[model samples]
Target: MMNDTTFETLPGRRRSDVVYKTLLDRLYSGQYARFSRLPTERELTEEFDVSRPVIRNALAKLRDNGLIRSVQGSGSIVLYEHARGDDASAGQVSIGDFQKCFEFRVLVEQEAAFLAAKHCDRAALDVIRQNIDEVDRYVQRGEYRIGKSFDFHRAIAMASENPFIVQALDRVQDFIGFKIYIARSMSLPNPVERLALINGEHSAILSLIERREGEEARALMRSHIERARDLFLGCLPLEVVSDREGR
Candidate 1:
């Protein structure tokens, strides 16, 4: 849930406009992942202390901008598909590339987890645990919160005590981030359940890591990435999914 204090009283700006832009920034920044439900109109009204009409107008603007779609009895669902880029003409990555990135993560992140289990200190493990907790809060609020999800994976890489592994993961971070968004988007009507399950996996892997169970952590990480890859690819058009297994 968005903090009540997140809304600001901008001098001379329309309340609806401020609300719209604030929500837009959150959508673009992955605070509200694609396909996740925005807070209810009443909830927004209370949070922003604005009239219901103002919240409706703000949502209308979001719909007009192709940022969200309204569902009868279901509130607004996010439609912002990718991260914002410098140019409007930024090239879209091929679906194949998305799958390949998952493959790369499975190969590298599994080993990273393995190494982290052996090399991770209490401080580093704490960071990963914190990321999991953050995701839990967002899930409980019915948001996917992809940014923290990425942080969880990156923290594991850092915990591996291998700078090269961390750099390697960074190279594909954006693509993998999109994969998370798309997967969660496809899980509409039950996104919270899906997110909870994924976060559960994160907690399970964290426990294994904390116990210094390197091989078990490696296997779990492999399964985790592979499962995520399959879920995301399942949402794509048949021809767009280049991997034979994905098809």
Candidate 2:
């Protein structure tokens, strides 16, 4: 049986909790069958009269809880039954798998950052600078702003002048954002130090790009991503480390 108390705190829930209860009832009643596709984002937005971001947040929560999976280029599919036996539910990432993910990121983002330096327009540079400033503000205020940080990276990726790189970044945005958020939330001591390091790296990359130093930009990006991989590994629990290695 689902934990009623904990369920009330889910993303779609409110003080009144109508949406939470409705969804939970439907889920338990099997209205969304195993392996069935959920309503599209547009459909859900229309049905609920909520903004797309709110709907996306709700779906993200569902996905994290193993109730659903969003297949890229397709749509969200119900995975409740499958999750009963799925390793994903345990939130494990193997070391090798984690390294592979970082490797892939380095390969793509270094080129993307270099191209962004080579081809980015003044307007795009302004956006990137603004994002960096936003991160600075959040850090100075001791505010946790993982979303803003992710947006900064996304802005850089979009400015890369490569459509494929933009698409790839978009696909992993949620995963990357959530992992950072989780790491920050779980930190025992001075999370600000780590966040500051990240901010400094962002500034370095942006500065290189603004100077039209493509090779320097690529080098900085590679270092920045490798650092992120290390931080993520440090933040993961022992059990999750095993899972990450397996992946």
Candidate 3:
């Protein structure tokens, strides 16, 4: 581990941005262990002398950057780990981490979608449908439920009837939760627009799966995930997803 590091207070930065950046630097320095829950919202609110919403927004930024994850009643867990100079104690989710996760998703999930086309029954598709509708409800209220989207994807993974694929996705799901939100947030800034686009994609995938069109389902799933990467991480060229779709 590297030596203990302290975050300096910067002048002229938004209070929430200050809190977010401070926490992030601490993360990059390995002050927080991966998978460990952070302080409660109340505690952070007091520590930062900010309102709950400020603390929430700050944490939201961390989540958007894929440096932390939210857990029910447990607060956010730190996921980012990085090295500076000779300090190589690794754990944080950098752009490199995001890209690696995206690559894995493209690899594992595309096949999962393909297999799901062959094996998915009405029950499995119903789970996805329910979750997608729930997501739309959240978006309608101008909120984004990252967990809901994760559930939708996991439903597809389960429909594949492949334990190994399901296991692999579960391993990285906590982190995947953040990226799902971030990509959706950036690619579709308007809640209504995002709701329509996300549900549309899910519907298309499910339709192809129901028809047992494995190859088409596979390609569309790959493209869908790649579209997210392009939106959130700029992994592919700009033209890979035109502004119309990303918007």
Candidate 4:
């Protein structure tokens, strides 16, 4: 809570909404620490000068957003602090660090794909297929789901039967999102085109792995990563990325 923790005089008509934004702002600002319980209904009511119902409704919104969890005995607890554009660290990745990381991943993942092609059992391949189908369904409906695409890659990493590969992907899989940011930057009339291409690339990779074409699978995996890297880099300012890379 701020030293000057302030609230506008919340009127009855929109008190619950005001309370929700107030609490969410606090959560994102770290006024409520992760995993720490929020004030009780009685305390919130007093603090916000709102009814218990207003406070409860406000808490419900946070719960719906997966930001907080409410236990029966305890109160609402903070979970994530989703950084918005204004956050100091938002989208401020070092280009040199990203290039190094991506280069390392290209090697790790190519081997993973090669091994997955050779060793993945039917069940393992099915797990990868399920994630692919999830993306296909979303893309058919014209949604570019970055998380779904990430899940498909994670499944392939798991199918490699290499715990290190799995662990590595878990750590760095979120980097794929820069590709999403780049695709969105283009502002194409058909946003689904980028997603469709991504899904198609995944389908081709999966097919090669399923057929146990280890050599071909490795090649496809490297090409796929390179293509996505190009797409992501294409939209960025070259001078900025080059300057940072030199650093």
Best by TM-score: 3
Against the reference, the lDDT scores of all candidates come to 0.74, 0.66, 0.69, 0.69
Write the residue-wise lDDT of candidate 3 on 67-124 in tens digits. 6889887889887544344332122234555667889989999999999999989998
Error of 1 at 35 (Å): 24
lDDT per residue for candidate 4 within 1-247, as digits (tens), equals: 2122234454543567667768756764568877888889999887777688778867775664456788888878776543446544343455555566667778888999999998899999999888888878877765444545767777888889999999987667345334323323333334468778888888999999999999999999899888766666556544223233443
TM-score winner between 3 and 4, please give it. Answer: 3
State which candidate has the highest lDDT.
1
Model 2: lDDT of residue 184: 32
Per model, how many backbone clashes are there? 0, 10, 4, 0
- lDDT per residue for candidate 2 within 6-91, as digits (tens), equals 54354543311333235434554458877888889888766666557656766664564445689997798876542223555334
Q: Is candidate 1 or candidate 2 better by lDDT?
A: 1
TM-score of each: 0.60, 0.61, 0.63, 0.60
Backbone clashes, candidate 3:
4
* Model 2, residue pairs in steric clash: 93-243, 93-244, 93-245, 94-243, 94-244, 94-245, 94-246, 95-244, 95-245, 97-247
